[model samples]
Target: MDTWLKESRKRADSAHHVVPIRSGVLWSEALMRQSMPPSTADPDTSRPNRIPPDVPRNMHDSYCELLLPFASSPELLEQYINASGGIRTGMLMEHLDSLAGGIAYKHMLGPGVEVLSKDQGFYMVTASVDRLDMLAPLYPVRDMRLSGQVIHTGRSSMEVAVRMEALEKDGREQTIMLGRFFMVCRDAKTHKAAPVNPLKLSTPEDKQLFALGETHKDRRRLRTSVSLDRLPPTSLEAEELHSLFLHVHQKVFGGYLMRLAYELGFANAELFTGCHVLFVSLDCISFAKPVPIGSILRLSSHILHTTSSEQFPGLIHVGVQANVVDVATGKEQTTNDFRFTWCTDHNIPLTRKVVPKTYKGPCGERLGFSEELLQRTLTSKTY
Candidate 1:
């Protein structure tokens, strides 16, 4: 793992050779060179420069166009369903993260995060991708081409327009997806935000995609506010958190733990439909001991109190625990816990009356606590 990370970092630091054409137009010959492996021919040997034959142009001939068929594949759908509880939102988040890393990086010169404030729900059903990892009847690999260029940049955000299409398919080529993604990049270590370097769009096609991104930004801003309170709660174990840690780098991504908290609390809500994730102001999560993977994680949540002045109710607290068993020594370990708070939507009044003192689940066990530490470690910040 350490070696892999080192090699990845080295590749990220290498300078890219940018080829200059007309003013405001730059292309990376280094990217093309890297796409091909080193040739066996001697450097001094003369080689013939042959003219390539003309190929039929397809309507979907774009970088992001390559990604569409993969996104639409039945095999890819099956893999998504199997991995994360068949929840489309989770699967879409994972896919957007993958695309943002690939296409978004093509426009940004450095490593960055594309914080997806809005949901990409069912959008990929028609989007494009170059390679689709259908971890199906086992995973199968398909290759396609991607073309992405930067459209706009702001104080702390940048937008990239991407197009993907099939390059060498024995079958028909189709327009699977076309869209723009807005990204907010930050310094990896400091977490302070940064701006994307100015991009020079050379093609009319590139200009068109950039314009689309500008128009889409307004709709995206509104959708970002749409709450996902209708989804049913899902459970997780300590082992799952450990497994998640192995893959995710961002602390915000690790907030899947908090997602579990929301799930637990909303399930127990007297008015389930009225519950929403109003805000998470501060969080200070710590792992006292590493929970083994595959442990049954149980979570329970409830409204501790309510507030009239606030946008939502008072606070919703969620408790999480892991059910673990030692394989070598054969002993059971229970009780790893965390808490979360949520506010109700004041604009939408609750129709159901609140239930009185009827909370259920394991209670009164200070399984892991220290007298010296009176306050909880995890905290949240409200919006």
Candidate 2:
């Protein structure tokens, strides 16, 4: 695809004593210049091959691929192998973040421009990860390739889509995962929002990808409008969250997953480059009623179940309640119940079990297991 930049493709400009201008070039001619005194050339010694801000950039112009030759190098593959003998997903996530940054910089600089000079006017930083969908499990036996391009751009933000493929021994590439990273360009000097080049869509694939990016933007806006923090869930969404509380599975709470993606990504990056942070499960027991706008919510949680024996360990069922006060009467009403189970670097230890002293405590637990709840759901035409 002419996307993988190789060492052989790197060339030097002897006339200006310039180093190879490519993404992966580790060394620059400036290394030698660093040993000598700084040269004060005329201030206006215009930088070479600088693409203008208004120039429309093609999707392919920012295309780059990185090959992880796991099959060929066993020693190197050991670094990425997890306890389950599979490639570590967290490391791949860190790399995806890195690749997205490079693609954004590539779109700003021309195709072959290597160094991100301070005078380049703009630089890119990861604002957030809009989405990360793992289509299939990754295999440790196969070599892998990661590739991505700048799909769409706004005034200061751009969408970078990355793909991971498992390269089979027989020369087949199976898609393993797909992700979209949102990057923001800031003026290098001022650190304010900077304009990004427009994307030039030339083909069907380009147009389709660009459309997906636009859809991402729209969906992000929609979620922000009705986010769990700002707005309450509808009856249907609340019911789904009830099922999520029962099972603590991902399929029922995709919205919460998207909301938590940015935090999870950065949390995993803490301590070291590829530290692991497992998203154990987010459980909401019940969304009884929506909190009205401008209402103050008093939130609290109670630990429910924990086995005294350590046989089936590392789980503590928590019930969190959201109470809102009536402004007129000054009476608090319980409106939400949440069950959270977490397993990451930090641990919350529970010795035996918890007994809630409040009037609603034992009743809430009993209601969770009541036969009437099941009967009511069964009688309903739609739940």
lDDT of each: 0.34, 0.55
Candidate 1 root-mean-square deviation in Å: 18.6
* TM-score of every candidate relative to the true structure: 0.31, 0.53
In model 2, the clashing pairs are none
Output the number of the TM-score-best candidate.
2
Off by over 4 Å in 1: 1-93, 110-149, 161-169, 218-383
> How far out, in Å, is residue 292 in model 2?
38
Cα shift from native, residue 14, model 1 (Å): 19
Instruction: Give a tens-digit lDDT track for model 1, residues 1-383.
Output: 11221222232322321211112211344335434544522232222221221221111111121242344476754554433233222233234334544444333322232222111110111111111111111112333333343455545555544333343356643222232445555543343444444444444544454455565565344322222222422455435533322321212222244345444554554244454433322221333233444444544454433323233334443344433466676676653344333344445544444333533322222222222111221221100
In model 2, state the lDDT of residue 263: 37
The CA lDDT at 21 in model 2 is: 27
Cα lDDT of model 2 by residue, 122-173, tens digit: 5565655654545555678889888777788988889887777899988877
Error of 2 at 148 (Å): 0.3
